[model samples]
Target: MKFGVLLDDHLFPEWRFYYLDYNELKRQLKVRTAANPQGKFAEQDEAAFVEILERELEKVASFRALKSDELERRVAHAQAAVDSILSSSDKPNETRMRAVEDELNKIATEMTELSKFVRLNYTGFMKILKKHDKHAGFQLKPTFMVRLAHRPFYKEGDRSVDSLVIRLSRLFDIVRTGGIRPPAVLPGGASQNFVRHTTKYWVHPDNITEVKLIILKYLPVLVFSSKGGKEFDPAITSIYLDNDAFELYLGRLEKTEGAEAIRIRWYGNMDQQEIFIERKTHREDWTGETSVKSRFAIKEKYVNGFLSGTYTMDKTIAKLRDRKQKSDKELDEMATLSREIQLSMLKRKLHPMDFLGYGFDHEEDIVRFPYAVLEVKLQNQAGSESPKWVTELINSHLVEEVPKFSKFIHGVATLIESRVTMLPFWLPQMDKDIRKEAPKRPPTALDLPSSSKRHLSVSPSVEVIIDRPSSVASTSRPNGPVSERTPLLARQEEDEEEDDDEQEQQKGKKSSDKRFPWRSLFASGSGTSLHIGAGGSAHPNAFLNSMIARENAGRTLQQQKRIVLPVRVEPKVFFANERTFLSWLHFCIVLGGLALGLLNFGDYVGQISGLIFTVVAMIFMIYALFLYQWRAHKIRNRDAAPYDDRFGPTVLV
Candidate 1:
């Protein structure tokens, strides 16, 4: 959809007047450009366009500032109420506690809307400016972008939003426990656990706010601050290193056993003196070892020298030892890691390939990621299950799971597309929007009042009628009565309700083609058996469709308590299987030769033993061939069944 239409669709009904006049600006540009028969605009025409653009920018800026202040006050008020309820000597009143919870919910909803408001207006301005530049043949975007950077509303990384999210999380935590806030986990606390499984998912920008609200109910946001303030910088910058062959990139992309990625990373900002030289090693589960990440911190001044093999970490280790800042074991480990990384860099001729994150001074290529990545790290005992909420969030429509997603690989693939032989599976998905229709959730105690329900019901894909008079439709739809123009909001609400009802009605209905479709696909070895549902039709790319099918199949297998292998089936895996088969055949040939020798050179008893040995040799050869073919078939079809044999080896012996 076009930006003009999308802007109108996602507009906050109560604050519609504050949005950019995108359509009007476009119409004005057309008229002004047409009057001048030449493509270039006259001085007066350019001035007129600039004047109108300035008005729109100012209007959006002022309104955003006003709304931001109002939201902050409301958050402070809610925080006070929460403290009162928590600090009371007696048990808090249930009604008061519920009221406080509702208030926080409203604040959170409004904050989300305000964020959307800022984003839509900023996008509108950019689109309109580009149109003006094209039609009038002027170079205005570069200068105007600088102007936009100075405006608070246009700054996409405004810290106020993060501050409000953190505060709301604390308040909601207090309300959830009825007076006690759960202990906050330090940012590095998860490192203490030796074994952890980290899964990454890409969150669509439209659903980021709602996703945060859902997670805040269970875990508090961890922030690092030097002055003990609520504000914290969330930026992390890293420079990935690789050779001209991109051996590290290929290794990491293929997920080869013992693949390693090297990078220099820093947190917060570029001015931070401390930097980490890190390496991530990938280990296959068949190796009976887990993947691990190791890093050692070094001063920023030594990075270039270290990479060039001029600086040694021995001096740094000695200084740390003398100061007693690190234990002897810790110093030794750091020294060993530093020496290994430096040697690897020099031997492999590794240099900077890509830069990730924000605000870097390097001359290397940098690519900004369009989507937010959420990493859920869990440290649980063996055979333990993930938390129910974590599982639910992963399955929800708000996020799309991209297993084994590597930032270095993505950066390299996107920045140096000409050099990359093959792109990652998730790269094709970038062209398509991952946002889906929000699922219908039952109302809870924290749900907003009826008057605010219309705001929550607006869908990103729903078309809203925007031609109505400003006076008649100033706010969201009312619950009491209806008017002619109000039907748009009413229809939206009704459609959502109808959707919920349809879902209820379809619970009992069954379709043979839809049930176990993945299983049938695996069994039949063809994509033709797959039924194209509305969701499947939306994603026309065959590769994306297959990925979705594999994910669904994996989820189903998980529900059945079965072992699941990697979804990606690389060609090397088949080669490995073939190699194993050849080894077994060689052993069988040796056994057959021994049986032949015994049969030819021995007496009757030796001949009888030779016959028995020959029979066993034949059985062994047959079993090995059969097992090889079966495993090859499974690997080709990308089956998720367990590959371990419980009785084959014992029975063969």
Candidate 2:
């Protein structure tokens, strides 16, 4: 299950030298294996080596004219001089020894310096990896509470600290249809441009975004770091728009083509400053030959060659559809390069699949526009074979919705190349609003085609886009069944009419022997709700018709009884309890989030997003507690008849 394919890879053998040096250090000077010779080589070793070389050179000088016995005698003298230095009597001269030691130390220092140059460059990578994990999760403050305590004694905010950083998660496609190339063709032929590096938009606080670039031997593509991410590294509220994809969009401005430093208000603070990011800096030199005849001439030649070439891809959707078509031997050679191009595009935009490798070990069908290289497997009609339409009949059962001939492949290639060259120049205001809340997901084949200058709708795909803010909002309804809301308002109006009819029928029931009067004295206490106790102290006499009861109670029995009894309520105090539970949850969530930080070691940012959810869960629990308490109070105080069987769980108020 290959996620992408590869082809036409190029490399320089000179770069191999860096790898060789790194491997050597891994073997020799690595901390685990080597013993520390320390500073002696900086001084002593250099002086000793130089002195021995000098002695050997002098012996060669004497060989020109000396007798054999004389030469032997000179060698003997040199050996003695070396031996005497090593077996010196008493303390050696401090001046002489210090100079020699210093020279040796110099040599050792030189060796260390040389090693640094030899290692391959992963300059930024080493800084991030070795110093600190770039994607660690946050931890909250600790909490303490005694057992059986009524409340956790701390300000709610003390335990409710959220992470300072927002973790980006997997970017899902905001819009998708089919292929990376727009369903259109490039304006010119294949030779018009070879766009190695390009960018479509730039994020800024105000209008006038800038795109900068640097050319690499291999293309130095600009990846909008924020927009493209995997599921694990979702763009949270801080970075992404509405939890969709985001990027530090840096691209070329139509007016300003030169390099100049521009101030753009970036999203995060200094540590996370992602604004004013660079796009491709250089502009292609436009050739003087802008004639249509010249453009078509090269295109015709390409068509002729492609028709005969083995690498020609045939089929309408052959742009990217069902791309694993080469034989196993060819595929093994081509897969890596194809995958690299796809991954590069993902990074330049906002992304999702894991760049370290695919986000996971499974194949996901990604319908993104690769950087303008669609495979076409073209097969020419044989000279002695059956008729052309008969060959077509052999493939008759298969619907040729996607064209498979030479002409179709040429169109597909042209379309992709054009889109890449004309990377969208987004409206500054639109881009700003998009940056504020674009969507957690990344750009996809289905997103509004930037080349949406033509029709709104097309078969198999729609070129519909929000040209105005109103259009964006209006299209949202019925874009996917949103018109259902209008009927709900109508239903509410009908319900109001039914309530009027029911009101008159319930009016005619009267009291029998028992009297219940409240509207007289209080004037507004009409619903029979009465509270006769203060902090649980008073209640009515239970007896009826006895002399003592008659004297104490009112004559008509509608009045309150004078002889009162103590009344009490089973107290439910949970507001304080609810608060305490929240405090505990906050503590656990903070620590649990940080504990989850272990995943920061992974290549993608999505793993850190899991920490954010813990805090959200704690918040939701607190909200639910309020709902429960409100419902409990509602059950306790609702209206009910005296001594009725249906009346249950009422508090004496």
Candidate 3:
């Protein structure tokens, strides 16, 4: 759609007057150009356009400042209220708590709308400036953009928004848990067993604040700290390593099994001394192994020498060993990992491909990603099952699932566009708007108190959902080609409903022959079955379909309803069992060979000894086979039986 229409459609109705007059500006340009009938605009016409543009900019900036200040005061008031409640010796007032929650929700909603408001207006100003420069043949954009930068509303990374979000998250967290504060990090720290199933989604810039607000309700904002100071932003800068041949890039792009990506990453900024040399190895599902990520820290000063193969981690390992902070086993593992990484880098001739930084100074070959990547990581023993809230958030219209989305691949494609033959599927989708009309949510039981529900007996006003117009027409210009300078103003499809439907239909057809009895899973208690429509098909949204599948599968599993959750048996467990079995078999083989030697080339006493040895060897072989099968079964069934043999090994010895 045209910038004017888009601005009108998405602008907060209450603050509609504050937005730039994009249509009026366009009209002014048309009239002046028609009157002149020439390419160049008169001095008066140019000045007129500039005056209006300046006025619009001033209007937007003032409104943004006012709203920001109001939001700050409201946030402060809410914080004080929360503090008072927490410090009180008396029982907590239910009414007061509810009121606080309501206020917080309102503030969150307003903040989201304000962010949207700022973004739309900023885009409007840019679009208008571009148009004026093109039609009037005046170079006004560069100068105006500088002025726009001075306006805080047009700038990215507003600290006020970040601070408010953090404060609101803390407040909501306390309220959600009934005044109990959770720890910054759980007990056991890095040693904790976290087998999380991570999924990535691409969030449009317009929806980032709202998405953050929704996520903050369930998960707290995780802030990192270092010897430097508390790094609240937790920004990361990584230089991905690949060769001139782009072998690693192709491997990662194709998601080939055992594909490895190496990178030198640092948190906060380049000034930080500690840098992490990280490697990620991709494993296919058929291999029964999940992808793994491992990293070892090194000083920033040593990075150049290490990459050049002139330095090894020997000195670092020696220091660690001398300090006695790490176990001998850990030190060995670290040394081994370092050696492997160094060897791989040297052998493959790996070098830096692209620089990926977050909230930091941009350097050469840096490709700033347009969309915010939201990774939902859930730690569940049952891989398919997740918390209801997380499921809802993923299924919501706020996110677009881009499976196996890699920052490295994106950077490579964007930075060296001419070099790479194959581009990622999402490359074309970058221009498309991922926004959709917000789904109307039914009031859940947890939404409000009984008293609040009683007040909602009156009929609600009808909410008209406006569908955005097609952008293919609006983006076309009669006089000339579209400018590549303003990517933000590029044409975009309003939605992907048709494409999504076709994809879902194909998936449905493929799974039709072996459709799981999803309805039966939910039929017992509620006497209601989840109707997935004809052909057992799902909704257009992929996340929603997966959630439905998970819900069905979870309900079907009898263990899911149990009080205690079962421990998941990883593929490594089975490998460990097999290794033990092989060791036993190895011992048996040695004994058997000795027995045969004695039987063939010794006297009757030797022969008798050989017979006993052969018999013992046979027993051991049989025992090893039995143990392997037993352990395999236990692991497969997730049995809580003890795996260790307290006396078997002793007796055998």
Candidate 4:
């Protein structure tokens, strides 16, 4: 059967145009054989590959069906033998039982091996089918069916078959969605290859919290979340390479914009397989042009060899050439630059200048926002260095600016501080400016323990150990000097501290009690609430219950506490109070009149409207009565003026 058009029409309609003929495939196989005698597929033609694939698939199916049936039969037979022996009236035979158990054990071991064999068979067939499918643009019928077909024969809840499908689905999702991109569009178009930007400041690590708070609003776009939901702001280790002459380091120190720094930076650990080698250059003359950073990754395995002067450029180029995934042009560009870096290291005798580490968190959908620290670095091909957005952001307190900050310089100074006599001649002035501008403690002087310290050796030839301070050494003391009285003294000190803490807590509790007026709210007095009659006293419980009920008094206590009209209130405030009650009275009368009018003349307005008017009238009358009582009490006590307003008028729309 010519499987060509039948499957190709459904799977890949475009395959017919580019599909290789059988003769062409045979010719390619011959050519490969001539080139490499022992290489895979060097001698085999297309027919041999197809035959092998078919035979493999057949073997997998036949073995699974036949072996599974045989295993089941053997296990069942062993079980039957044991059952027969046990059911018999004769005495149980130990030898027969042992033989039956041995047979059962052998079946179980074969079952495990069969399961693995079946899994491997499926995996191998799928892999081969996929490769051929890609070229032919048509998958093999049985292989495709095996993958897509629903397995009704498997036992319920058997997830063994489901795992492969789930894995494929996840891989598809990642390939479809996961790619490097900017969260938002840059000033220029998307085609820009490089963006130049400089650090306004490398913030003090002590102010990390403050800096985070400042940039909280911008973080939605600036930070990426890991699978564990942590904002990935990991410290990236950068090893700066410099020659013995210190020309690059000197130029950078002197603020020469043209000077460039070459470095390799990686996150977390140095044992990673991929690390970026970058050449960062700056230009001061170009307006708004801050810096240009070009970067590429090399294998981690090559890093040690390159540092030891064993790895050559030819080897690097050969590795690039072997990568079939990359294009010829890409390989050439990467190799050329790699060759230059390796050659420069050899000729100039480049050595490790410093190890710089900085944390960078970027906003989501980051197409390319490459910076070692929290500062922004723009890579625009146009070399546009205008930072209007950045400036506004800093001004808005999204981020604190650190002027003329370079991680390379900071790392060098901090690492070799004890060994070096004075700060670089130019650096002292910068340091003085920083100190003068902000006279706060900087975290640059942290005393880290030797075991946990992130150290960068200055030379590849020898490892340098920077000794930690005595304070740091003291903090990590594993075994303290023991004395007979030590445990007793420690217990005594702990007990004293606990007692002091308890006393402080008690003092605080007492002070809190005096701070708020709990007595005034629950107090039972004449001035505290409305009275039922002249010289009447009400209990606090009855008053609270009356307030909650908000209705006519039912109990004797509530009835006695119910407020009535009082005659001997202050006159000036009394008249104002009367006027306020009259206004509420007028409102109630107006609402009552409206309800009556709606009932008499507006039959067309509907029953719901008339009902609503009646309800409003009843509510207003009740509110007027409550206000009259509340105001009369306030006036009688002179607790608040009659003209004083507490609650606003309720307006119903």
Best prediction by TM-score: 3
Question: What are the lDDT figures for the candidates, one per model?
Answer: 0.62, 0.23, 0.63, 0.41
The C-alpha TM-scores of every prediction are: 0.58, 0.12, 0.60, 0.32
| Best lDDT among the predictions, by candidate number | 3
Better of 2 and 3 by TM-score: 3
Writing each residue's lDDT as its tens digit, candidate 2 over 360-432 gives: 2211111111011111112223343332222332232211112111111122122121212222211111101
Model 3, 1-653: lDDT tens digits are 35565666677778878888878988898898778968668999889888888888899899889988898899899889988987884566667878888887778778878877876776666666756786788899877866765664654346568788888878776665557775554211343122445677877656677777766655556554464234454455667899888888877776666889999876554487878888888765546777877778889899999999999999999999999978888788778888989999999999886432223221111122445677766545434455555567678777788877776786666445445666676764553456666634334222432223223222121111111111100121222112222222221211211232245553563364124322211111110111221111111234234435664665445222222221334568878998999999999999999999999998999999999999999999998998899887666555777987777778877
- Which residue runs of candidate 4 sit more than 4 Å off their true CA positions? 1-193, 202-207, 214-216, 220-233, 284-291, 313-323, 354-374, 379-389, 396-400, 414-653
Q: Where does model 1 exceed 4 Å of error?
A: 1-65, 82-99, 117-157, 173-195, 226-231, 315-332, 355-368, 439-653
**TM-score of model number 1:** 0.58
- Better model by TM-score, 1 or 2? 1
lDDT of 4 by residue, 1-653 (tens): 12222123212222223222333333443454445544434224445656654454454455455665675566557556755765664555556655654454344334433433433333333334433544443445455444323321212122332232222222222222221122432211122125534444423222222333222212222221223333343234566888656666655654454677778766433355666677767555323364666666667777867765787556656665787756677667766767766776777777776432224221110110011135554333354433333444345322344455555554444333333322343232221111113222222111111110012121112211111111100111232222111110111111111222146654563453343212122231111111221211222344334333542343344234321111223355656766777887798788777777777778666455777878987777676667777876665443434544455353532
C-alpha-based local distance difference test score of model 1: 0.62
